[model samples]
Target: MTLASTGTVIEVETRAGRVRGAWRGTPGEGGASAAFLGIPFAEPPVGDLRFAAPMPKRPWEGTLDALEYAPTAQRGDPGVTLIPEPSIPGDSTLNVNVFTPAPGKTTALPVLVYIHGGGYFAGSPASPWYDGAAFNRDGVVTVSISYRLGFDGFGWIEDAPLNRGVLDWMLALEWVRDNIAAFGGDPARVTIAGQSAGGGAVLTLLGMPAAQPLFEAVYCISGAAADVSVDEAEAFGRRLAEAGGVTPDRAGLSSLSEERVLELQKQLTAPAEGGNPLDGLRQFVDGGLTLGPVIDGDLVPLKTVDAIRSGIGADKPLVLGATDDEFSMILSEAKDKLRWIPSRYLLGKVGLTGKARSAYVAANRTVAKKGTAAIVGRYLTDRMFRTLALRIIHARGEAPTWLYRFSWTSPTFGMAVHCIDVPFFFDCLAADKVDAIAGDHPPQSLADAVHAGAVNFITTGDPGWPRYTAASGETRVYDDPSTVIRDGYAEVASLLPS
Candidate 1:
C-alpha cells in the first residue's frame, strides 16, 4: 500500500493491478475510512461476452482509478426505489466498491459484502444505504457488489449462459478472496448479506454446494426468494424473445438492444391489460421471480428451501427476518376503498377462502382490525417473506440461526413496509430520503439496536439473540424498545398448510 503526496490518495496492489482510492473523512478520525469504487472483478460483459458468463478481469497496465462509483446494471431509473440506487452509464458494470478503515495495515478485519435487491431485474450497488462507511467505522471492512440484472443477466437462451447474475456473484466473491486482503479485509472471515432480491441472492448462495467456501455468515433482511425452475425461466425467455421479434437463443436475443429487452420485460411482467388489481397480489403468491437463477441441476441444483432442508449451509450462522408489514404500503391507496369490501371477500381474491380464510383472519385478529387492505397486504408479506423465514428456520433444525423482526412502523408510511428495515440495518439513518418514510424524527436508538446486532453477527457469528429452534422459535423484534419473544411468527403459522 502507498499514499500519494497530499495523503488523500491511497493505493493498494491487487492481483489485477494497483488501484487508487480516496479518504472519506479526516485521516485520524474514528469514523474515517477509504473508499475504492468501481473496481472490476470481471471483464466487461459486452460484445462477445454479452450473454455469456463473466470472464475474470485481466491485469491492467497502470494504476486504475477506482475513485468514482461505477456504471450499474440498473439502467434508467424508475423514479427511485425504496433505496436511492443510481444507475450510472457504462459497460464495465460488473464491479465492487470497497470501504475500509485500515488500507495498508494488514489487520485482516472481518468483512461484510452486501448485495442489492430489485427483484432480480433492477438494482444498483451504488445506493447510499449500501455504502460501507458505517461498517468500516466499526472496524469491519465492507464491499458492495454489482451483478448483471434482468434478461441480459438471467434469461435462458440456447447459447447464452443461465444465471449470469449468479455467476457474477461467485466471481465477485472470488475477487474478495483474492484481493480484499489488500484493503485490510480477511479473506476467510467474510459475511455476505442482501435485502429484497439481494436477500434472496444470499439465501440462494447459502444453499449452493459450490458456494460453501465463499463466506461464513448471512443476514437476510426482508428476503423474497426466487427459485425459478429451468422450465419456467425458458418459458419466460422464449416469450421475451418473441416480443422482440427474435429467436430465443443467445445470438438472436443479444441482437436486441438492452433498452428494448427491458421494455419487453416490463410488457410481459405487467399485469394483464384488463385484469383486476388483486391479480398483482396473486402473481407474487403463485409466481416466483420470472428471471433469476434456474434449477439447472449444475450451478443451482434445487429450490432454496429444499436445499436448506438438505443441509447445504448448516454450519454457517444465519440471521433472517422481515418487517411487521413488508408490502402493506403497496395497498395504502386502496385502504378507504377496500374498507367497503368484506375482508373475507378480499381474502378470497388471493385464494384464501372457506374455513381457511376464516381461520387465518381469526388467528390474525389484531391485523384484521386494521381493515381489509391491511389483511390482504399482511397476507402478501406473509406469503412471500415472513412465512418463508419460518420455513428456513425449521429446515435448519439445529443450525445456529437467529431471527429478528423489524417492527418499527414508519411514521410517514404508517407500517414497517418494504425496504424500511434496510437503513436501520446499515445504520445509515442520515442518508438521502430517509425522512420521506421515517418522518422527521426517525429513531436513531432503534438503528443503534438493529445495527449493533448486525455488526455482532458479522464479527462474531452470533447476533446477541437467542437461536431459533423448532421447540421454541425465539425472535428479536426491533422496535423503539426492541425485545425478544418466543414464537414471534405464531400468527403467521395459520398460513401454513395442514
Candidate 2:
C-alpha cells in the first residue's frame, strides 16, 4: 500500500498483523517522514521463552498501534553519559522501529537497519538520537531494533541457546526481509550498521553463514568482534549463577525474576572499590557479563576475524572505523585519577610493562601529551578498536572496504570520544538531550559529511572515498575539515606485538 501524505495516519499490513503509523511532517515542508514505533518482530522473550532463540511473532488480530517506543531489557541509569537512554517497562522487547519518507510506496528504497550499542549490556531504540527522520528526508528507510541484553542475552548456558542476542538480530533481519516491503523498504538493498557492540554485532553477523543474505553491506563504527569461547562463556554463566544463589542451568536461570537477573548483572559489572577507573575497562576486555557473540562451533563456527580471513562475507562492501580517543570517553569520570597511576603500573595490566611499555609510551608520546593517563588511554584505544578495525580491513579480501577515523574533538571532553559520532551519523544533533555530547552548536557540516557517507554506502555501496587497499592503507579522517591520511597509525602499529 502507498504511504499516506504528511500529517495523516496510515495503516499498513505486515505479515504478523496490521499497523497504524503517523507521518511526522508534510512532504512539501522538507520534513516528510513516517514513523512506525514498537512493532514486534519476534515473540516476547518472557517466561519460558526467556533464554531461547527468538521465535517468530504469532500473528495478531486487529491493527496494532505502532506509535510509541517499547521497553528494552532492564539496565541501570546511564548517569551523565554522552547518550540519553530512556527505559520503558514491558515484556515486548523484541521489537523494531521504522522511519520512511512520506507517501511510501512499493518503490523499494534502500533500507538501513541500525542496532544500538551499549557494550552489549544495555541500550535502547528509544534514544532520541536514533531518530530516523533525517534519513527519511534523504529518502532512505531507517530501522532501529531492540534485543535482549546482559545475562539474559549473552550469558552462555549448557541448556540455553548461545548468543541469543545475535539470534534476536537474525530474527529481526528476517522480519525486515519478510515485512519491510509494506513499509516501502527493499530488503535486497539492506545495509546493517551499528556502533560499539552493535558494530560488533554487524561483524558477528558477517561471520555467520545464516546472516550472509540478511544484509548487502556493513557500516561498523568502533565495533570489534567479541569471540568468547564456549568454555569461557559457560564459566562466566556459572559464576553469575553462583553469585545470584541459583543453579547454572536454564531452569534455574528462567526461575529468577528479571529484576533479580539484572541485579546480578550489575553486581558482575560494578567497579570494585579501591580499584583504578580502568578496572571496568579491564573487565570488559576480560569478558565481563557484557560477553558478546560466542564462537559456538555451530551458529558461529569461527572467530569473526578468522571467518573474515577465511572469506566469509568477503564480497560485501564494508565501512568500518573508530574515533581518535575512544578510551578517553570511557574513562572520562576518572581522568584526573588516571594521572596518579604510574605508567609502568598502568601498562602492567595489559602485559605491556618494561620495554614493551616503554616502546609504546615513546611511540604514543607525540600524540598523547597528557602523561601516563593519555598514554594508557591511547594504548587501549588502539589495542581494542583501531588495530581490530585494521585487522578486519586487511582481511576483507577483494571486497571494497573504506576505512575512517572520527577525530572531531568534543568541546567538553577535548577529544573525539566513544559514541560521539552517533548523533552526527544519524543527523540527530539537534535532538533533546544530545547537547551533552554535541555541545550547544555542533558542526552541521560534519554531520552532513558523516550522515551522507552512510547514506552513500547504503544506497550505492561506496562512501565517496577510494576503496581500501593493503598497499596504501588509506583512511578518511573526519575532523573540522575532513582529510584522507595514509596509514594514520603506522607508527603505533609497528610497536604492537603480533
Pairs in steric clash, model 1 = none
What lDDT is obtained when candidate 1 is compared to the true structure? 0.88
C-alpha TM-score for every candidate: 0.97, 0.94
lDDT of 2 by residue, 1-498 (tens): 123335567788999889998887664577578889899998889878989889999999999988878767745565223677777888889999999874347979999999988878877888888888888878789999989987888898768889899899999999999988888899899999998888998999988888999999999998967788898888879888998788898888787888888788778767787886456666665453347888999998898888998899988899999998887655656668767877668777854667766777777776556766666777778878888888887777667899999999898778888889998899887787667776898898999999999999999999998877878878888988898888866646744446
Worst 10 residues of 1 by lDDT: 1-10
Give the alpha carbon lDDT tens digit for every residue of 358-387 in model 1.
Answer: 888998999999999998899889988998
Q: Over all chains combined, what TM-score does candidate 1 have?
A: 0.97
lDDT of each: 0.88, 0.82
Question: lDDT score, residue 308, model 2?
Answer: 91
Best by lDDT: 1
Which segments of candidate 1 are over 4 A away from where they belong? Answer: 1-7, 78-80
- Looking at candidate 2, the ten consecutive residues that score lowest on lDDT are 1-10
